[model samples]
Target: MSALPTTATHEPEAPIISAVKSNASAENRVHGLKLAILLGSLTLVTFLSLLDTSIIGTAIPHITSEFHSLPDVGWYVGAYTLGAATLQPLSGKLYAYFPTKAVFMGFVFFFELGSLICGVAQSSTMLIIGRAVAGMGVSGIFNGAITVLSAAVGNEKSPLYFGIVLGTSQMGIVCGPLIGGALTEHASWRWCFYLNLPAGGLAVLILAFIHFPELAQKKTFSMALVRKVVPELDLIGFLLFVPPSVMFLLALQFGSGNTHAWNSATVVGLLVGSGVLAVIFILWERRMGDRAMLPGSLVKQRMVWVSCTYGMCNGCCMMIASNWMPTFFQAVKGEGPTLSGVHILPSILSQLSAVIVSGALISKLGYYLPWALGGGIIMAIGNGLVSTFTATTSVGQWIGYQIVVGAGRGAGLQAPLVAVQNAVKPSQVPIATAFLVFLQNFGVSIGIVLSNVAFTQTLTQAIPLYAPSVSSQAALDAGAGAGAVRDLVRGHEDELSGVLRAYSEGLRNIFYFLVGMSCIAVVLSLGMGWVDVRKKKDSTKSTGDNEAQEKKVEEKSLNEA
Candidate 1:
């Protein structure tokens, strides 16, 4: 709860440094072919970074079977998420202190290394480790891409570049399951990891040739500078934030099943430990002030906190739906993995389409709140309808329901970021943006864990009640996968009917949970203040002068950082 930092530093060199950067930036502005190449590389990296998050979902059953470790299903996704969340904040600091181009390529190399590990992993443990490493690499890609793009183009063109990258990454999310399914079915599941190699290599190669503008001060590295840069990176905040996050997510992942019950000592201990660590984290952040992961200075703003909360909810909806939809279709509808992925396209396409439309509308109207509220309502309705799905649910019903939720999600997903960015000073935008992205990704990790618990718990209880002859342990052993369930009940008509019904009900329970999440988003969206994106009407002279001033201020801030 410390007051936010003011732009009132007393450093003697600040003004001189700012003036030098202002002049140099104009000279280094990128254009033409070089600009296009930078954007294309950024778009590719963004796509691959996000692609890993959802691609594993369709292949989870295959991974589970190969390792004979059904209980470790959630870890496949959560492990990668843990790494991403842990390193997310630090990446922002790293960019501030190091050469952006070198740092970005280094992270990409790390990502590729991870994918290689996963592709060659012989055990479930190895795969999880690979995922964690890959997640660490992905953690930096999005932030780095944004920073590079912002520097590559002027303010007027930045939004369009960001939109193109965002849309492409989203399409990657939609295509992940399809790609995972195709690989797992026709090729080896390992191909999913190998797939990243060539595409990522091409991106890195392009980045190697394209130079981006960087603060001149960061080019020099010395032992003397280490002391100065270390505090700015805020390693203490990172250490405090990561443990509690890991504990909380692990507690949820282990909250059910034969080995770990809700009230078991392991679960109870982790829950209590997570709470204690969270309290410590808050205290630590309060002390760190501007250096905190969720910096107290920027977070004190109302828009910042509201946007963070909104991000958490949005992340939950996005990750849960993306990860679970393929599983649901295969299990309840008896579709193959490839076909199952295809079945969910209506929703993904609509969400992407809505995002495009939403951006245009918000740009014109200048207010994002209406879209946010409207999206929440529509999402809630969609989830409610989806909660009624059963084995007999028609194709039209599922597709229509998905379209509704997809549209809702797309409409409001970026609004919170817009609100926060507009509310902050130019200097605070980087940290503010990083903090929001961290919360959103953290929400994704939490959502996947919660969904796993709910789905497993429901299926565990319902399978026994619906089919008294089938053991709950038997169904549990089959895994939370359509193929697994089919294998278990194959040639047993009555058992198949009961197990399918149980699976359907379990999926419904998850949708119902999302309904509540969507409703909460609506309430949070209402709390967002009315901020217009449109430029205020002013005399031409004043408008030009203000633009010039703002540009200098932003560039100076970037240089100082």
Candidate 2:
């Protein structure tokens, strides 16, 4: 027998996505222009936030130049990603407990504030701080976008609408480097951040006008309400989660080339502390039971953990590759930032195309497992091909290889998400999504750090071997930016080719890691039980249906218990 559950098992009694169909009549639904405006605003915000993540990759070289601080580049990216990962799951509970519109708008305000801070940052430390704040907002926005979108359109059409949101948002990510390159070259690196201020403000303004149905709450604020809300947010779990994540990322950032040696006291202490914190967090969550950030019952499910692992590996493979390609083009081929961004269009376009096509196929065939498996296999092959790139690799080869990688990533990017939605009970869907998103972002943080470690370690070793006159420490001091790489080797014409070759080899080394990660993703994906999303049925009265589903789930839970 297949591992896939043919019927509902023990799940939650109440759905996280409100059964608005039963609560609100058809006549009261937002449609036409109002609906368009709401969705458009949400989609725009999503695009801008995701765009910020990739846009900085191209701008980093310029930013490093302005501040003359090459050592902080990893922190710049990792700070935002870490912040987002930390807050992602918590945001789900916030939405569940508060007025949806208000909570979402509040996050937008903070996101914009962070963007403004980044736009005017005068130092690298200030910029890193700004990125962290902005990431906090992004985490909430991501969770809210899907939650509100589902509630706005109802369950029947959410899949299609979600596809649109994801496609549009990813378009921002694809176009980020292009826009960042243009702004950084023609204007200033600061403009890359300044652009978000106006755009984010506009999104906030539009969101302010739209009123989403509010969950019932206390009419007046009181200590009692605060007491009730604090525990629901799982503040203790939040505290426990932070130390390990912070320690782990700090160890990665500081251990290799950034500041400290791997065996240095700081690095060793952080790694050991992180391990201890992780154990404590797991034990804490187990004690918290259902109130935990990672609820024990839901997390123990085979499908949930499998999907989460796939998401983590998928994140590691795709993000590490996408963020580093511009540097590859700039360093190896000596392409200008704008042209390098343009060259990456093949990967971006293919990824976008695959996502849309795969989404439609999932909707039509109702099966995501085949696409997930195929995507993982294709991605592994793509990354493997990319790992063969050399200093003199032909343009056609690079482009073709990237296309394969992009297509593969796009095909499976959202497959795990789709599987989670289908496998979990309606009530558990939101948390499950949040958990996956957290894992994905957390994976992204680790991937970028891992890439940094590999790049710095390999480049440090290869530089001196290939170009004996140039000190490896000097190149290490140049930081992870392409511009810095060129500047460090500028006067030594005889050593330039050797240095470029070293950079190329170092990059290829990172791809080798990505290839392995992609393969691991494929293995994890195999455990996602087969379920046909297309053949799924939606009952007219979800509230009544929910009750029946609950009874079935209860029996299963009891039997297992």
Residue by residue across 300-399, what tens digits does model 2's lDDT show?
9999989988988887777788778877877677766777778888888898889889988888887898888999999999998988877689989999
RMSD of each: 5.3, 7.0
**What clash pairs does model 2 have?**
9-553, 10-553, 366-533, 366-534
* Tens-place lDDT digits, model 1, residues 1-561: 345322243231232234333323655678989988888888988898888887887887667656765556667777787788778888987776667898899889989999999999999889988988998898899888877877777566777888789878877888898998898888988999999999999989988988877644453667765665676665877888878888887787777556688889999999999999999988877776665667777888888888788877877887788777877787777777788778878878888888889988998888989988998898899889888888888888999999998998888887998888887876777778888878877777777777777888888899888877777777767665566777776666677888888888888888888999999999999888887777532354587899999999999999999
Q: How accurate is candidate 2 locally (lDDT)?
A: 0.80
| TM accuracy, model 2 | 0.89
TM-score (all chains, Cα) for each model:
0.90, 0.89
Model 2, runs deviating above 4 Å: 1-23, 68-71, 215-222, 480-483, 538-561
